[model samples]
Structure formats: C-alpha cells, structure tokens
Target: MDAERGEGSPHGGDGRLRRRAFLVGGGLAALGLGGTALAIGPDGFRNAYARVVCGGVPDPPVARPGARRLSEVEGRTVIVSLPPRPRDRTTVVIMFPEGTENARASLDLCSADRYLAASGGRFAVAAIDDWPSADVVGTVLPHLETQGFDTGRIGLLGWAAGGAEALRLAAQLGSGRVAAVAAASPAVTAARAPLRDLVDIPVWLGCGERDDRAPQTETMLKGLRALGATTEGGISSGCQDTAYRVRVLPEQFAFFSRHL
Candidate 1:
C-alpha cells in the first residue's frame, strides 16, 4: 500500500508515468493479515501491481501495541489484534495490503492501533490472507459479525489495488453494512463498482500531487460524489504515490474515525 516518488504526473509534474501490474496467489501474506504466498515475475510485478503509481511524504512508523493472533475462521485464515480490553461499540477494520510483501505491514500503515487507542479500545482489527471481496465477503462478513463486531460499523481500507478492491466490496455489501472506505494511490484501472450503490457510504482517497495515480483516484471520488456517496480526499503537494499510504495515514485515521 506504499511507494517512492516518481516524476511527470499530469497533476502538475513533468516526468513519465509508470504503472505496475501484480499477479498474486491466494496464499500471499499481507499487512498484519499473516503472510500468503505469491507467484510473480522476477521483474517485480507482484510488488508493483500491488502498489499505486505516484510519488513522497514521510511520517512516523505505524505500529500498534497489543497481542497479535493468527487463526482460522470458517475455513479462512485471519489475523486479529485487540487492545488488552476492548470497549463497547467497537468498529471493525478489514484491510488488504498493496502487495504480498507488505501484508503484515498493513496494520501500522492503516493505523489499526491508533484507531483502537483513539476510540478508547472501541475498535477491533481483522485481516485475511486474501481480501474479502465479492467472492468472499459473503463468508467473511458473516464470520466477522458472529465474532461480536457490529456489522453496521464496518470500515474497509486498502493500498493500491486493495483500495479499488475495498470499493468493490463496499458496493457488493451495500452502505447499510459499511460505514467507510479508504484508498491510497489505488491501482484501479477501471470503475467496475456500481456508484449508484454507494449513495450513503463515506469514502476517503489519499494521494500526493507527485503521484501519477492521483487522477484516477480523483476521478473515482468525483464519480462517487456525483452518485451521492459522502466522499473526501487529500491531494497534498509533493506527495509521492508510494509514500502517501503512511504519510496521509493520520488523515485517513481521522476520516475513518469520524465515519466509523
């Protein structure tokens, strides 16, 4: 879900644009979700396609303090983290990372611990080796609900391709069940999710000016807004596509906090 700076984004830079395509196996380990195995080209398609095309902002590392657990639920593997004591009205954050390599790294990048702390232990975080999408939300959603999470307070976060995947899940599940969705430099090449279905969902897109993926994200934001989804995004000057996931994480945390 993060990356380095590049030049020539139409957002105002003059460098050539670059796009990375990923091919992942179901076993690839993702940020804090436990590692899943991957099969990719030696050229790094697994890493590149999983990240967004952009350019750089720096921030403190994203880490949470608590015990981490890996287990199986309903035939799927999941990683869960909780504050020593959780509060009532907990928000459930389900995330997908930018690449197979950063699967476990996603927990900090998405500010899972910060949410738990900010909400006074009112957030429970969970992630899986494979993102819960149209193919799996049916199973993942019900399983999470059975585990004591408020299905109505779900939030979805992803980096690069994951962001678009989050949007796809939001559309499939409907706003009645999802509260917020966030994406950073997502590698979404098409708008496959039905905008009409996101009328009441709140979505936040974070990307930098120097990042080449800004236009696509901004376009998606515009589409979501036009379709009446409550949407907002931060377009920071000099922010790189690779770096925005961490750099704008604080902003993302606040957005999810308000919506969740």
Candidate 2:
C-alpha cells in the first residue's frame, strides 16, 4: 500500500480523512480565515448543546395552606399567613410573579408555608397578590407591621418574573427595611427597570444551567454588579425535571439567617 494512502495516513483514502478535512474547512470558513471569529464560536455551540440536553431545574415544593386575604389595594388583594410553625422568628415576604391566573398558580406551587416549616420553623412566610402597578413594598409594610414583624429582619423572595419585582421592592425599601433578596430565574431583560443602590444588601440568584430563563438571570447579575452589590449565584443540581430547583431556597434562608 502507498504510504500516504495507508489506513493510518493523514491523507489516507479512508472516509475519516475526508470527514476531518470537511470539518477543518468548515471551521476556517466560519472563522473568516483571518478576520474576527464567528459570534457563535465553539464555546457558544457547547453551551447551547448543554442547555438543550440538560433542561430546566425542578420547581420548589408548593406551600398549600388555606389562603387568607389580608388587604385590598388599588383593586389588588394582598394576603398574609403563618407557615406550618407559626412561632418562627424569621419572616419571609414573597412577591408572586406577574401575569394572570397563572401567577396565582405559581404562588400556590411555591408552597412558601411548606418551605418555612421544613426549614425548622426558621421562617414565617407571607405573600402578596399578583403583579400590580403600585409600590408593593409600601402596600405590604403596614400589614407586616400589624403582624408584629420587625421589618428590619425581613427577607424578600420571588419566583420567575416576581423575582425581579422582589429585588426592585427591596432596593426601594433599602437596607433598613430589607436585609436580603433572593430570586429564582428572574425575568431580567434590557427593558427591565434597574435596581437602586444595593451595594450593602446581600443578594442570592439561582437558575438552572439549562433553564430558558438563564439569559434573564445573567442580565440581572450584570445590573447587580454595576450597583456594587454583594451577589452569590449557583447552578441548580436538579435541572432535568422541575422548572427550578430547591438550592435557592436553602441558600436564601442561610443568607437571611446571616444578614437578617
């Protein structure tokens, strides 16, 4: 057999050489042969692949306890409730994500009551109504006060679109009333309003590596960094089944424990 045409030869007549040559030529073409490389480079391709294969994280356990209407403001109904363990010292304020009936469904699915109870009575959970056009923090402040909550020790938590809303509320309240904020797959787009001074507040951001909402989380992180905020982020371990994972909740609880 001719040396160049042997099975192990780089230029062998076998199919492998042709395939390798095609791949190399395609890569060079994509790189413009001299100019800047393609915007979607090899790394981008890999990331896209990972997202497609891994899927989104699992949703946190739902807190299903009979809902009690707390107040009605601007045609919106706000609610408050005690978690399984009503004697918990920690107070959690949850801002439900935006949209219609689905938003309410998300609040129910989150099961804030169950989460707090599972945390060993470490938190007393409360939730606001669906997305509204007013200052949610201001709307709920009075109710929280009546409930004997020390606003200074309160932690803000939100899910999906509500995550951004929660952060915005926290920023508005400042570090005095809100000690920390937690978000899961926040809908952080360019058009999303910017958060106020958050440099002194602690923030926890959670997203599934393969979540469709990853871009939003990335944008939120960038905004937080610009404000010189102290931010911690993590990839959820369970992204193959549920749309979000549980790591964010525990991590958020820990953050509140330390800060609040």
Candidate 3:
C-alpha cells in the first residue's frame, strides 16, 4: 500500500490551527494500513489516497448478455464474459489471484478489457476467479463460446499463485485452446513437475524490484529457458500492489498482442 499525506486547519481562530490539524491527521493515518494523505484546499480537506484507490473505479457488475457467474469450483464462484463486440477474433485471459475471491484487489481485469478493446476488437478477455484449475478453464470455455468468442484463439494471463496455475494449465492444454501464456510475478518453484518442461508457446514472466519473490520468478525463468521455451523476463520499479506489479500488465499486453 502507498503512504498518504494530508493537511488541515484548526478551528476557533486558533493561531496554531494548521499545526494542530497536521498532528491530528498524522495520528489518524498512523493507525491505519494503506492510508492516503489529504490536504486543506480552498474547498476544504481533500484526500489524495482515497483518490488513488478509488479513482476511476468501475462498478463490479458484469452487465453483458454472456457476462454471468459460472458454477463454483471448490466453493468459489467464477465469472465468464465476452467483450462488448463479440464477433471479433477473440483471445481469452484466464486470471487467477493471490487473495480471497471476494477482494476488490482481484478486480483488475479492467486493464485486460481495455487492452483487448484497443486491439481492433481482435481479442476477448475472460478472467477466471479460481486458483490454477484446468477444470475451471474447461468449464468457462463453453460459457465464452455462448458469448460468441472463438475459444480456440484464447490465451492465459496468470499473476502470483495464478502464474503457477497458468503454467500448469498451459502444459495441460498443450496448445489446444491456449495460444500463449503470460505469467506476471509468477510463484514458480522447482517443486512443480509440470512447470519443469518448457511450454511450446510464447511465455513471458515478470516481477517487481522490491518483490520478495524475485528469486522464485528468476528460478522459474531459468527453468523455462532450459526447456527450450521462448521466454522473456521483465522487472518493474515499484513494490507489489494487490498481488500485481503495475508495469507488468501493459508489457504482458504487448507480448500477447505479438504472440497471441
């Protein structure tokens, strides 16, 4: 979470109003994790942190005709949907998160939507809610087809735990429905047998500079290279935010655009 800054004035015409307001606001911020700062403006107090977290946030409802909740896997319900323009050539993104199913942090599929829409409607993006499950992907395929997507051209985008899942699913599919796989901040380790072999499709892996799991990502990349896979690794400057390294998504978009 990012730190916050705030400013305010004291009431009752106190000479120390500004100083007092600063102390109070600072105290309030100290008690909270992921607090944003505010400043006293002509219109009164303004919160910068709230702006960052809530800025341009979209509604949670998936309102398209084919946009509906699918059956739950292991008690967690998954969502499947098609882009607004369904007839275009489609690409599927199987998203898996590193947190609880209900958290808003896992709702970053908006970026994926934007990417597909910008690509001449050449792709459709679908975010799966369950952890690395091939069954979930299989279940969502028909739902995507109902939305008019070409499931044969779909791709996978996995982050953190989902990255590991993406690799597993890629190997499981073996170039069937999946065209490529992109793993951002993948929690790849030597223990996974499926990830040991290099995937035949294009694979892109990335991590953050301040991420504690950089070593694990590097190990996974090395393993993929050893398997004769077409692989690329990227590094971002910021720390992990909501299980995603912000820069990795755009890069992944470019990779998918080129390969998928």
The residue-by-residue lDDT of candidate 1 on 1-260, one tens digit each, is 11344444433232221221122322233332113223333234344333423322344444445556566666657666665466554567777776653335667554565545544444567777655332346676677667666666688877777777777778787778788888777777536555777777898876676668777767777887777778877566544444656666667767777877
Q: Against the hidden reference, what TM-scores do the models get?
A: 0.66, 0.60, 0.63
Of the candidates numbered 1 and 2, which has the greater TM-score value? 1
lDDT of 3 by residue, 19-120 (tens): 555665565466452234434531222343333332323333333323333444445555544455654545666676664453123544344444444443
Model 3: which residue pairs collide? 4-37, 5-37, 5-38, 6-38, 10-17, 91-124
TM-score of 2: 0.60
Q: Cα deviation of 191 in candidate 1 (Å)?
A: 4.7
**Candidate 3 local lDDT, residue 114:** 47
Poorly placed runs, candidate 2 (over 4 Å):
1-75, 87-90, 101-104, 190-196, 219-228, 237-242, 245-247
The list of candidate 3 runs beyond 4 A from truth reads 1-89, 102-105, 108-110, 118-121, 129-134, 191-193
Clashes of each: 30, 7, 6
**lDDT score at residue 180, model 3, on the 0-100 scale:** 78
The whole-model lDDT of each prediction reads 0.62, 0.59, 0.58
Cα TM-score of candidate 3: 0.63
A best-first ranking of the candidates according to their lDDT comes to 1, 2, 3
